[model samples]
Target: MKKLYIFVLVLLSWNLQGQGLPGLGAGTTPNNKPILHGKSWVAITGKPLGASAGATIFNQGGNAVDAACAMIAATSTMWDVLSWGGETQALIYNPHTKKVIAINALGYAPTGATVDFYKSQGMDYPPQYGPLAATTPGTPGGIMTMLAEYGTMSLEQILKPSMDLAKGYPLEAQTANAMEAQKARIKQWPYSKKIFLPHLGEEREAPEVGEIFVQEDLYETLSKLVEAEKNALAEGKSRKEAIYAAYDRFYKGDIAKEIVRGTREQGGLFTESDLANWKVKIEEPLHVNYKGIDVYKLQEWTQGPALLQSLNILENFDLKSMGYNSANYIHTLYQAMSLAFADRDFYYGDPAFVDSPMEGLLSKEYAKERAKLIKEINDPKIGPGDPYPFQGGTNPYSDILNQNKEALASLPADQLNSSLDPAFIEAFQSGTTSVETADAEGWVVSVTPSGGWIPAVVAGNTGVGLSQRMQSFVLDENLNPYNLPEPGKRPRVTLTPSLALKDGKPMLAFAVQGGDSQDQNLLQLFLNMVEFGMDVQEATEAANINSYQMQSSFGNHEVRPGAIVLRKDTPAWVNKELVDRGYQIELWNKTSGPLNAIWFDWKHGSFWGGSSDYGDDYGIAW
Candidate 1:
């Protein structure tokens, strides 16, 4: 009788709140992982070893910037879907400046990477793999720049973790399996075959799980960088100067010469000048104030602004009143995202090369205008809006828009559908890894570093994998005039890192690892916390909807209009409503995440880190 009475009282409490589960205020929530508590610092990333690197830095008296650099190096060395030669995109919140800054380390197209060059080869877009797709390396410059500008540690101290990993580390199952799966492609590159396939003639050419995976060439390259920094420091150069000394060696010294020679050997288009001219830019990030919280993201060069635009449009709706994951709420979020992503697909690109109407695109009035287009159903034919008029300029691409509409109208019905094949799914969900770090001193960092996955083209004896980001560029202007392939132009990429501030202090730092689905998942994660009242952990683990309306930024750039993915646990009635509303529903066991986030518990003066249990994501707080 006592147990029955207690259960009845609990049920009554939930009924009184008018929701299925008590969210943020609840004593507990359903989760596979507990919220990490930290008083001094927290480090979270795609792998356990990566987080360990950050923790090591933190323990060595290094601040968040130094720790973040160490984790980036460690992960890059570990080949966690990235390499030393891949590009890096980051958002760092500096405690001293009380500002969030963007790091643009994206590699650019080489000298001969012209549209005509690709067209001469009978290709509409750049090839998805191999030497033809390589770009000027950017990750090395990015790390050195950040360390010199904001970090307190020396280059040697920051790079020690990666150097150790480069010598040898027990290979994990997933990476080993990936290498084995793509061994044929890996064997195509002589240098890659020499390093990755230790057992060439055996049944398994790639290293097995628990085997010591070594990269002697990469270790030597790292040692050379440290030697440069040490030589400069010994000569009485300042810490910043010493770091730049290492940077110079990588870009203009022996390292650069070797990279150029090796790349040319693989039929790549790299020149010494391409590597020497590349520099990392530390610039102001773009942000929007949503319901009193400021959300920051990288600029037009990345697809980040789309999330800001989606937030601006969503502000017009009363989300909480619609109930979490309800048909109405899902439909509203999907429509807003569709509107924003349509613009992203057509307009977002390298701002240095194109005059993207960002001032108007991010305008609240423009969002209000876009919001008015949202109806009770999804719009498969959704296209970019005219933001030029909002910014008081005339539309220069009006004729281009007309031609796009005509092209869409001419497409066959079957071709418009989503391909469920393994290959297509692989392209659609092309992966990256995220890094999130925070400390008691108020420094915060979020990074989405990617490019070199498995089967990468290793540049001769350097053991460094070249970036395959060139495939993101379109050869034809009609597809995206702003993103056409050209020499020295950075390809518009999917890498984005998010930071939110409230009351002039850090509120959240979050990022995810899906290709095109990154911002889509991030948008929902933000909403789940602010609107639905879920705590950071709940928000990170929440099942979110995914729309396949936007063109992919990877292989073939396919778009599957009206298709949406829902979690298998979605209510039948809600699923039925969505199908009736014209959505081609696809049930997924997990809709979108692997999201990693950190929330500032101001009231408690501590950090609450959330690492979703879906993937290899891990977090360590102390």
Candidate 2:
């Protein structure tokens, strides 16, 4: 009963905090509007309650890493967090150390996952869903890693709100809508059905708004992890040591053994050693300069550098003179994106495996040469450009991809044919939620945790949903050296969380989820902030264009070829001009991105933030 009282008080406080930002107070509006919170500290998440979760951590004097992890933990409980079986990739900026670190909290294929293994089973490729699509979960260890490296808080403290939330929490509109819509899919997996579709009557309907959604199983799973940490602490482990102990329990102990046991019992490819030896990569960030600002993103394992390559090419043109959202500006955006993707197709592979032409790809000379390919007329036949005299060679992956061409031809490929509209692609690329946070002292963290949603399955009731990221790995060999299904190779991914620095200090930190569109989304938002002189809120609300001219990062990997998706409200002249340029344009009522950003104006000593929606309580603060 006391717990119920505390929860009620928290709800009341959430209502009160809703008044934090003017004009966005405690409303039942489905869409959160964009707003500016110019305080010394701020946070932004997909849901208002999520931001509140971070606020609690910040109030406890937690740094950006702690607060961001806290909010994500809360997110993992409520909606698509664990259910999506996705990995959490993050970029953390420490003002004290004056260094930015990249956390490649990604999954790798099990050792037994060989392309030939699938070929022998009458399957040319790994299944896009089910046990075959899974990898050892990285979220559990990823959060622990951050807490050990940068956070002052412990796992037990950070996960408290999330644990409470798992017991029960009110449903938001998007989450409730997803729950109802995913019923049929979730029902196919008994464990998923048990968590999401526990009905009291013969007729099971989607839970209504404000309904209390509960997940005792997930809570128990998390509790066990926390208990493991506590046991270590009780045994005289330091805070960091306790975190490591918990990591061992999750990855090398009972949990790992259970997952392996389940996999063998189910005839899956995973083994106990697969979990025991797995490790997340702590890589140095790839740095690029757009004008004077230094932008950082994960290396080739993610499609992060695509932004650098595209922006480099776009810099050759007079974008400002073309006008924002105008047909000329939109055309240039599409053309530059096409040329950059051509380079990305052949060169942007795992640097460790492939001789990634990184040095040449980011060179201004390469951008200048690639810039020459941007034409007023659309050309679907466009392919890769030379990064240098020695590099940018033949399409290595094409020969193998061609061999399996017939295999992909027989699969459920290119759902974009349904509408080729923004709605379809938006649902594809931007289906995941994003979170960002910053402390008063200049620490910042930006994260995008996506994967696991389309066809979610529990790892044998371990409460860790496996990410379907195997969909990103190719069965064809030598096609993309970086993403081959080797035992320890990281799959080249579409998740890109970015950080911007000016004068060797943190300036802007943001991230968005839109698959390959993440590059377009981040580029637009960055340009919106730097070029247009828009504040974070204005930049977030600014209408942007999306180009689908490149091969998809997932699915059957069909190229969109001269395709551009625009907002429905774009000036008719923009559409007309694009049509005249031999382009395919499909406009929709919504944009393909939901951006969350926080800006640090070091000179003025102020922090500002905004999201896709505006509510008085919208942006994060206590």
Candidate 3:
């Protein structure tokens, strides 16, 4: 009996140890990380390294806007996969004004770029193809604009941390992994290779955790910008000239010329004139009403409108009554997503070029018509409906056909016998990285920066990357303008940052990294919070399901896999329901993209924050 008691005691002790704390000492989950003080606003991002940069700014008496500026600079250096000399968009919710102001830091295609240029080169546009595809980088300008207008600190103060970190910092595992993945591409650009490579020529082992990684040129660039900021303030230099000088030095001066020469030699279209003519435009964000609340999106130039359209379709359904993640709930969400994507593919584009009837599309009458079509397609296999008619012409079916053909042609020729040929890349395109913050005063900001498929990485310069963003044109067979490209015209973008307001107050500031998944993830995050009433952590960590079985925004006919991907922690019952709803449910051990979010609880006057648990190491602070 004594021996039995000892055995039982040991078993009990083991169980107690197992249950002591969920993520304690695990170092893998945010749940284990310490929470910050309640009143202080917390910023979350994909990397803790990047989050630390923002947190430092906040700790140093910076306001939410200042913190955002710091975060953007840090991300450009650390999270280069989704950041860097890319485009950016921001939505600021000002409690004082009780209004949301938007900054369209999105880069525009240069006036000189045209489809004919690519055709003349006898080369097809590769998705990841460089410098010729880049638009003017808008991130730096956007940061400066936001800081000068809404922030409390000077550019020098906001950028100091980023500059220091760039000079030398230990590479985290995530950054190292990304560097290795793009090692080949990094090698192609001398400046990139110098910073990312070990010994400057040969591929070296990734820096161990805590080992310092340095980018002296990037540091110099940040320093130059800071110096220019000071000069602008002290030397009577115009803000425009200072901003132009900073960007010009990075792009057109030495770095940009190298990139232009290299790309032109390789049959790319980037020109000196394109660089000189490039500018970031500030435009009005698209707004729609949902549940009597005003929701703003980044206008027709990006996929932001899809979020509104999805919400409109969802408004027709009783999501709250359906039970969160239930078969009915998931089905309704998927249906709404399908309808919105249909419109996104057919209509959404650079509004300056495409006559996207913003009002007609968001109108209840149009939404009802679209919703009825969604109901008609119960099979889930049926794709999007015809686009709404314009003044004289019907829906643009030919464009859809062309996009579909291009997607099909992109398929690997070796996969002729394969049953599953990806009509388009399942992964998101036009990568966007985001930052979110809400202060005690109720000022909330969500900013997303993105520019991809722009062959902008100038050779020999770590400071500048030229964008090749002019390829999004609708043209005739003769390579003439079906839609003529124009200056200051915002191109089709995927980066969109959003804010959730409840009763005229900021509830949460959220954004995701995937190109198309940005809106889908945002929608799911909203449902997880509002309908399911899950805490911020659970909602972000919850399993998500998306369909490739339909047409994507770029007009790729995705074979709807009807698959549902859930975080490993998802409840078994939720899985059963998803399967019952005809979803090919797959449980992912870990997903890649990070969803950054912060929640403001008015009832408790406390703030709760959470970031992606998939792999990113992020935390909150007082």
Candidate 4:
């Protein structure tokens, strides 16, 4: 009541003019540093405008889910890579019900995307970019669903910020950098080049850091959806029905048809059925008790469970006693994550298609048995451990695991070409957005929205986007236990979001955007906060480390066994020690990008917003 009391006074003094009461709290922080904190409903989002949009929503009587929808709307429009026509996943915690709901909006393969289709094309795998790589988008439906089920605001209100952003907005430094880095992909599509490569100072180039970038088509696209909702309202439909009307405009109406026409005309194998049949699945969230704190993650379809599995193994050790970021700590994280990710490479996929052995995979007893396999020295390769065998059941993935091992055994490490080069990593580094929100009433949401970008051909004249995530599917069914290309099956993605609860109360929500780095960076940031006693802001500002030891989820599925990267600021001795231990170590430049999270102090009835100092990450707490 005390913190809430102070928050009321702050909000009471606040207005809609973008002004703040300074003495009451440090409501915001500058870029390239820590972050701001306060005792109120807070928004930590990918960009400043997104955060501001959330703050406005919160002040206007919206709940956390409403604010989350508003922030994502702004994020999708501002960053082309973290697009409107993309994939998304979210974990929402309901305090009253003590239930955490998982929203999986990641797109699925079109009916035409199948092993036989790839075989007929003489393609070993789905191409990494363009129309050939598209999947049925899920973001539009996901956002609308969130608004319909959980949000308080209407589609028109939440979408207003995005409409403004798409029609015209100043290009931030982060987007400018993305435009420059993904220049080649942008050039491949006239629609993208026209939007992103606007002429600056008499030269056609990536927009200068603060120049304006406009997407007239995108503005029209979003407006059309809103028009549908408004028309439904005018016809005396319920608010929820109006939201559904808006969703239909994108999923089954003219927009969806236009998207199908555009992609198929550009050689994409898609039909209206793919878009109409698309639906976001809501399921129970996966949870694990980590050192008495409950942690929630997406299911096995994502690389999410790896974080929990790693926690289970690491729980056996005294991490604080080992000293933070020590050689022992780093080695242990590497080994544990390696083992979990081996399982990820072999077992993680659309659960509808594969038996993931979820019961054993999440059991503490299984983690104990698997921990015995971690050696004192690092192992370049590990097992897709037989979770079912450990749990005294039949292992469904056994045959596929054995086949994958045999395939790798036949290919020498030196001859294996990886797709995780400078260019590929740079493309990922350019994209994605995350939002974390917590309201005074205790509703919380952590969402990681990603995929659609410049590389994919635009969706016809609709001024919309489609995902290139079909490449995440597998070519050889034997090598991919759960990720074989199948109609209506979601791809095994790296888009994992994390939620933390203290003593049965929701405490923290977080997500990141570096493809495979999503889990690694998030795992590190979580440990930084919970294990090393760092605040949310310092946890993000802290230097990061990552590994590419597992076969990538993206194109080519290359394995960079035992490869590890650390930021230069990490102690030189730690790098030398890891190298001495036979792990391939590369120094990362500026580590990871724009990781966002929010922590709620239930005891104080306060909320704290945090973000990485990198990119355009910003926080608003008032």
Which scores higher on lDDT, 2 or 3? 2
lDDT tens digits, residues 298-365, model 2?
88778888888888888888776666677887788888888887667655665555667777788888
lDDT of 1 by residue, 449-530 (tens): 8887787888878878888899999887888889998889999999999999999999999999988999999999999889
Lowest lDDT 10-mer window, candidate 4? Answer: 15-24
lDDT of 3 at 31: 43
TM-score of 3: 0.81
* Candidate 3: residue 408 lDDT (0-100): 49
lDDT of 4: 0.78
Model 3 residue 507 distance off true place after TM-score fit, in angstroms: 2.1
Backbone clashes counted, model 1: 0
What are the TM-scores, per candidate, against the unseen true structure?
A: 0.97, 0.87, 0.81, 0.90
Ranking of all predicted structures according to lDDT, beginning with the best and ending with the worst: 1, 4, 2, 3
Which regions of candidate 2 deviate over 4 angstroms?
A: 1-34, 81-85, 121-125, 263-267, 388-427, 477-481, 614-618
Question: Which is superior by lDDT, 1 or 2?
Answer: 1
Q: Which ten residues in a row have the lowest lDDT in candidate 2?
A: 19-28
Q: Best candidate, TM-score-wise?
A: 1
Once superposed on the true structure, which residue ranges of model 1 sit more than 4 Å away at CA? 8-27, 409-415
Q: Tens digit of lDDT per residue, candidate 4, span 1-622?
A: 9999987866654421111112233334332564556665878887788888888888888889988888888887876366777888999998788889999998888877888898798888887788778888788888899989988889898888888878778887767876777777867776666666776344547888767778898898899989999999999998899999989889888898888888888788779998898888998878899888899999987889999888888888788767667788889888888888887777778887777787888888889888888887777657677788666798765677777677767766565442346755653343567888888777899998877765546778766667878877888866565788888888888888889998778878998877777888888888877877666776776677777777777767767776777777667788888888878777766675578888776667787667886666778887
lDDT (tens digit, per residue) of candidate 3 on 1-622: 9999987866665432232212223222334334343577787765666778778888888888888888888777664444455767888876777878888776665545555654555634312445555565677778877776677777778777788778788777766765666676766655545566665444554455667887777677678776666666677776545654556554566655754665565445556665666655656667667776566777877778888888887888888777655567767787788777656655666765667656766777677777776542234433344435423346545566456556645755443221223334433344556787767767677887655322235434545544434544333321212223455455566677887677777777778776666788887876766665656775666556554444332322233445445556556786776666566655567542567778887898878775666556465556
Each model's lDDT comes to 0.89, 0.73, 0.63, 0.78
